[model samples]
Target: TESSTAQWANEDCDTQKLPFVCRRAGSVSVPAECPHEAQKPGKDIIAPGFPIHGIPCEYMLAVDAKSLVHLEILALEANPNIDFLEIYEGTMGHNLLANLTGTISNPAIYITKSANVMRVN
Candidate 1:
């Protein structure tokens, strides 16, 4: 599923996997509030782990924690028109939601903010 869900930087974001998770590998510095694993919606989110051995532009979205619930933020090789997003809550927990209806690209994103999903870039 990680292969089929995985999408290239310029490809459609309708699937669950992406080659790059953000502008570049390790784009976001996952804070302590939001971890790369299952997260608690009502509590402070830990930052995701920065992609390891990242290339200049090539990005990666890897699981930092072992859980079924978590946001796997992928830095894009190059910032594109991120109008759509493949929200994989992980395995069967994943879902595809347009940024218009989905959450922002930020790992620290929370429902406390505007419920309307927006583009992070």
Candidate 2:
């Protein structure tokens, strides 16, 4: 219901559409508006929304890392033990935290496909 643009196709939404619009983009921290409740994937997940690819939004904000204003630093749920907490791909990286100290968890090893497969002897 947040997508004011979805209701109309190529028509000026200002005349007949609601102000709220849902523009879904990948790895984008800030979306146009919160995704529609019906099309929502799940709760507590920040990036849970219907992805509208190949499209852009009229109203979107960008907060550059270098230009972010420092109002005040706040404490999080974990500290001292927590090295860093980043909001990646619109989702808080809580899943990675749980597996940090387990056998199945290897944060150091990342999965990558290399073109030179025959290099390994």
Candidate 3:
């Protein structure tokens, strides 16, 4: 069930009438050969093998616990229908903070809520 605060609870789907979101896979596939890396602030996270399609990379960013991370997307070039960049709030990526795709005109900003760690995939 869904609460008045807009949070989901453990309940049968038929018990409540709530709107849900779904995603369908497109023609593009997830890159099989992905290289993982751990990064600190100030390092640029770029997609491996730039200009090549079907290439994806994962990165973990850790910072001082007392500080929050500020992520600025300098540039993004991809087909919005297929490619995407997802930013999660923690190492496990249980909470999604941002999903970016397609061409970006200006720099987009994303900051941590409380955790000093974030995952990019």
Candidate 4:
């Protein structure tokens, strides 16, 4: 089921099977490597076409092996219940640092626990 505001609808939790729809803003191709635009500090990772629709994006932020990467969400505008930002320590399967959703009133900061790799999805 689709609504004006993006949301998850469990039409039938018992017998209905629904295909997952993934959305992305713009025509940008998923890069084999991290995009250069996301490699800088203090960069904002706004949803591609924010305030309209949010697409599924995977961001891998990597730094020098000896250095640490810090991620801060300066401002976020999205449905807290449906759209969210998942932060992992190293990769997607690694330790989850935080699951951020909703309008962030206070800035959230996360530091990598191990290695210089942080995955955001």
lDDT of 1 by residue, 1-121 (tens): 1221232234345774776554332233344223334333334322232222212211123333432233334332222453333343223323332233234354433121212221121
Alpha carbon deviation, residue 18, candidate 3 (Å)? 60
The residue-by-residue lDDT of candidate 3 on 1-121, one tens digit each, is: 1222222234445876656543332323322355554665686665544544447777777788898778889888888868888999878888899988899879989888988887888
Q: For each candidate, what TM-score against the reference? A: 0.22, 0.14, 0.66, 0.64
Positional deviation of 22 in candidate 1, in angstroms?
A: 26
Q: Look at candidate 3 and tell me the lDDT of residue 112.
A: 83
Q: For candidate 1, what is the lDDT?
A: 0.30
lDDT of 4: 0.68
lDDT of 4 by residue, 1-121 (tens): 2422343433553565556444433443322333445556555665544444456778888888898879987767768688778888886546888888778878778998776888888
lDDT score, candidate 1, position 78: 24
lDDT of 2 by residue, 1-121 (tens): 3442343234445785766554333343434454443221111222222233212111111234333211111222222343223321212222221222112221232211221111000
Error of 3 at 79 (Å): 1.2
The count of backbone overlaps in candidate 2 is 0
Of the two candidates 2 and 4, the one with more favorable lDDT, higher being better, is 4
The root-mean-square deviation over C-alpha atoms between each candidate and the true structure, in angstroms, is: 15.5, 18.2, 16.5, 12.0
Which lDDT values do the candidates have, in the order given?
Answer: 0.30, 0.26, 0.70, 0.68
